[model samples]
Target chain A: MHIPDGYLGPTTCGFFYAVMLPIWAVASKIVKKTLKAKQVPMLAIGAAFSFVIMMFNVPIIGGSTGHAVGGVLVAILLGPWAACIAITVALVIQALLFGDGGITAFGANCFNLAFILPFVGYYIYQALTYRAPAISNRRVLAAGIAGYVGINIAALFTGVEFGLQPLLHHTAAGQALYCPYGLNVSVPAMAGEHLLIFGWVEAIVTALVIKFLQKQDTNGFPPKTCGNDTVGLNAETTNGRSL
Target chain B: MSFFKDSVFSDENASKNGFLQSLDPRIKTITFLLFLVQILLTRNIFILLCLYAVSVLLACFSKIRLGFFLKRTWVFIPLFSLFIAIPAIFSIFTPGEPLTTVKIAGLTLIITRPGLSGAALFIARVVTSVSFVVLLNITTKHFELLKVLRIFKIPQIFVMTLGMCYRYIFLFIGIIENTHLAVKSRVGIKIRPKKGQRIVASNITSLWQRSYQLNEDVYQAMLSRGYNGEPLVLNNFKAGWQDWLWLLCALTIFITIR
Candidate 1:
């Protein structure tokens, strides 16, 4: 999914970066509003978690192994802004440090996985948890299904983005190259791969991580780890200040 | 690029002269993106070498260390192999000319010419892009990078969530670490649950509940602070001449090369 550099034609790749950078900017401002200072390090560690956990390469059925992005879990714990930025940072670090993704294509990868997946997954989870009669066997089942479906849809969007490349790069001479690998074969195949494999991997891991975070901080608010917030907050408390 | 960030920001490297500590986030971002584009514009072996040289030179001038760049490649090589190999390894068995033949497990292992070519293409692309991004982080602060995002016009809701998450990520890790440590101190890494799957299930359910509660608290805090949908703005780091020059260079190369 990380479009390593130079794989896509320059025009297509450049267009994506330009498109995504603004999206990233909007996400950043949202993150600034959400942060209360105390949550900073946890998010950084979350960033680190994203960088490390995605590298685990857990063994599954075939010779291939799949990793989790933990987007839903991050959203549940940190909210979408921090989750997106943290995930973006994690992805950036993964690309720079490990070359897992391409630098030129980082915005594209970030757009698909970080921006699209978590936000979509969060709302779907919320919608399911709320609309359903109860968190019964049926509701949980529905929530799981919705989350899974949401992930697949995001995957489909990514496939389409990748598929548009050859079409956009279409020149008279490049048409012959299509005979061996037409757009028909590539786009749906990539989408199908995501829907079947990547989505499932994302769904299960996300569900697990979300479930885990919910378990540990049973009080809902995470423990305080920053002194600035506490000092500033406590000072206000003592001085009888209120926003 | 990787080396530049590691030397300045890698937890341990902060002690060195913080040359990159004060650059405008927007400048760092624009340069980083352009540098990535520069790498992407080349496929010829000579151009790849030149791209690598340019990135290295930039890092040296910026005073970021060489070690930071190489340290990150450890995670990439293995992970990248998996990324490219699935599609690539599958292509080898499609009845093409065998590039190499080997015997294993009483069967012949074949690498086809097409598969070999595909792998080469995949590797080259991965290397060229990853290297440039490695440079970006080495030269830029993560927070400043986020500021750059806001300036670039990404959604405020989205950025706020990411930034708050970054701020609080450590708190959750500490809690989780303490819990893990407590479990270890008492049980010393038990292989399996004493009961059945119920223990694991219960643990998972508890975690889910906690995460929800945490977000609820976060919402309360935000509501009390007047968080109506408008995103907070840094209002710094405007794009200047360097950005235009960099973009022009990228545009020129992209059009001329292909």
Candidate 2:
């Protein structure tokens, strides 16, 4: 979920940015080492794919539609560290260019969607599928569950962030300076919707895409090793070239 | 799709020979960040309103249509922030001196004074911040904005990735548009929900495959052209006296407000 400006106090925004700075640094280092010279094109294409994935609205109940974040899917294909960088780049473009998210809140949004979502989703899928063949039904199921749990976790973090605002920032008279909802309201409101509707959308999209890619028997669809190898890039450069 | 294409892909407003358009994008970006910082720090509603008015005036001076800018900024407020703000005005959430009372079938609701003021302040902050951000975006070319990231010492590779991503997003969007049209033409706009999801998933896979292929091709192309891993960027940002004057004025306003 994209957090807009003014929803969180400046302190909260600053805190997230401080937290994300190291994570971003680590991610870039890992991606650079893993993908090397190929990191540029691979990450660029991944970021573009991540950006455009949000545009595909899938039909839901009652003729409504929802879009998938595709963070987990990207992680499955490109590894979590690369997914983190790709999604962060996409979020940056969204904030700076389209105004889809707030510039002030960029760090918070990336922490949730870029960091938490992909890392949690990828690991969960890894644990579930552990050593299973890539084409197995279990892998598909793992992806679905991973998507659902990943998004719900990210949403929970967002809720906690929003809920904390009232307690953290307020006037002398107890008037909220930012988001007014306490944990009781924000948690349920955010996590509940995702749990019921958006989570299922994410799950279905992830599972179906995984199934399709598996059916196509695409080589290196899900890299055997996560951060250790670059999967979808040129094979010769997979060992990574020296800068 | 048209809305996405228009709002994002079209840089007509940025290309216009307007005030913000003429300034160095790096300078404009920094000044806008200053405006956002001021907007975030202030709790005073009057100050928020003043900042908002200044954003509006900036938009006008930048040759942005007042109606278009207002609609673009306010539309997000209602969708993202208003729902939260609405409950903030009620006595249940923001307990304080009652400003007004409302009665429904069997209940009385008290809108607290503090609640109203807090809600108004939150709305003002959101609007002002969104205005400045929207203003900055609409008045600066997307590539220029990407280049401005270099000012923060973001790694050149990361910035280059971002630039390439921006360059290809439109191409993917076009592919998505064509795919949607092809799907609609065949499915006649009434595909079953499961089928619709299947189509979407397939399209996503198709796009990912295409991107993967293109990634290899582009990397090979880069290698052939002597890319050598380090991307060189043309630094053409020239901040004139007017840009410095604007920065000085912005800094002064920021300090004065503080």
Best by lDDT: 2
lDDT of candidate 1 over B162-228, digit per residue (tens): 5654454445445445655665587664333222123333343454345434655776676687766
Q: Which stretches of candidate 1 lie over 4 Å from their true place?
A: A1-8, A11-67, A70-103, A114-131, A153-243, B1-11, B18-25, B57-68, B77-79, B82-118, B155-160, B189-258
Model 2: residues >4 Å from true position, as ranges?
A218-227, A231-243
Worst 10 residues of 2 chain B by lDDT: B76-85
lDDT of candidate 2 vs native?
A: 0.85
Worst 10 residues of 1 chain B by lDDT: B193-202
Task: Judge candidate 1 at residue B232 and give its lDDT.
Answer: 53
DockQ of 1: 0.17
lDDT of 1 by residue, A1-243 (tens): 665555566666667678777766766655455455544335555565555445334333454567555665455445565667767877765564445666666767787778787677666665655533321343344335545765676667666765665465433423211112335655686678767776666665555444443334344232232112421111111112110
Q: For residues B25-50, what per-residue lDDT tens digits would candidate 2 score against the true structure?
A: 98889999999988888889999999
A1-243: candidate 2 lDDT, tens digit per residue: 788888889999999999999998988786776676764687888899988888889899899999999998888777788889889999999998888878888889999999999999988987887667645798799999999999999999999999999899989987888888889999999999999999999999999998888786454444432335563221112222200
